[model samples]
Target: MSLSKLKLTTCLWFDGNAEEAANFYTSVFPNSKVLHIQRYLKNGQELHRQEPGSVMVVEFELDGHRFVGLNGGPNFKFNEAISFQIDCANQEEVDYYWAKLGEGGDPAKQQCSWVADRFGVSWQVVPTAMKDMLASEDKAAAGRAMEAMMHMKKLDIAELEKAFRG
Candidate 1:
């Protein structure tokens, strides 16, 4: 049987730091690298604007996923409507990402999720089993789990499980 896989690539647009952001991401994730780099040419003449050979486009892979970074100028900025969710297995994982990504950014609390990072990207660092526990058949159990999650900035799986079982 042939199965069709849905492959989605996220394209990130930056004012002029697409290359910088790609490098930063590759450093943070394992099995990541800058596959290709391109520079912009204007009428057969390389523009000596800003940094020479500054990243026009960067093709990179992070954790086996492909992403394209476009230095499409600063016409747009990232908003909270679209965010990345990081499913963590434990508090250690949560703390590590929270600290690293939250550098030079503001933190906004939303249950077990927060918005941080210098790029103004929002990340939801949640426990791995949070969704399963939250979707329990028992309404009271699920409610309890949600209640616990709502009070936390970083998800605690142990506490969520406790609430689910109680």
Candidate 2:
């Protein structure tokens, strides 16, 4: 399906590596695949400078969300401001995502469960339990969890729960 059909879709800009990025992302997430790839034609080759048959945009689905990766060159780059949060069902799921997504990423950039993949795309591997603790009306418990979270890179669910209960 095309991204236009969705009410909202995220589009990522890449420097001629959209295909590789799409493939990697699909491999990391289950129930995901590259939906369609749009290639540049001769008509805009003059302005775009990309080869006529080169990739222009790669449309893919990660889990259930659709995303378009555009080979728009080096004008822009991904940053820490925006990130996709993965809500894991348990500590095992959180650990799995953390290891897969954090591979070859900048260790210095990792903090509070946020990791920037090798592609420079930031992702937050959050435990599903964290939501309840953080949203709890008991501000002290929420504060404790938040404080505990601030001290860690990959979040420890047990630690957060202990802090919350204290």
Query: Which candidate achieves the best lDDT against the true structure?
Result: 2
Off by over 4 Å in 2: 1-6
RMSD of 2: 3.1
TM-score of model 1 vs. true structure: 0.82
TM-score of each: 0.82, 0.93
lDDT of 1 by residue, 40-122 (tens): 76543444344545677899998888999888776798877788887777778877777777777676534366756677667
Error of 1 at 114 (Å): 3.0
Record all residue pairs in model 1 with backbone atoms less than 3 Å apart, i.e. clashing: none
In model 1, the Cα lDDT at residue 138 comes to 84
Worst window of 10 by summed lDDT in candidate 1: 43-52
Q: Could you give me the TM-score of model 2 versus the true structure?
A: 0.93
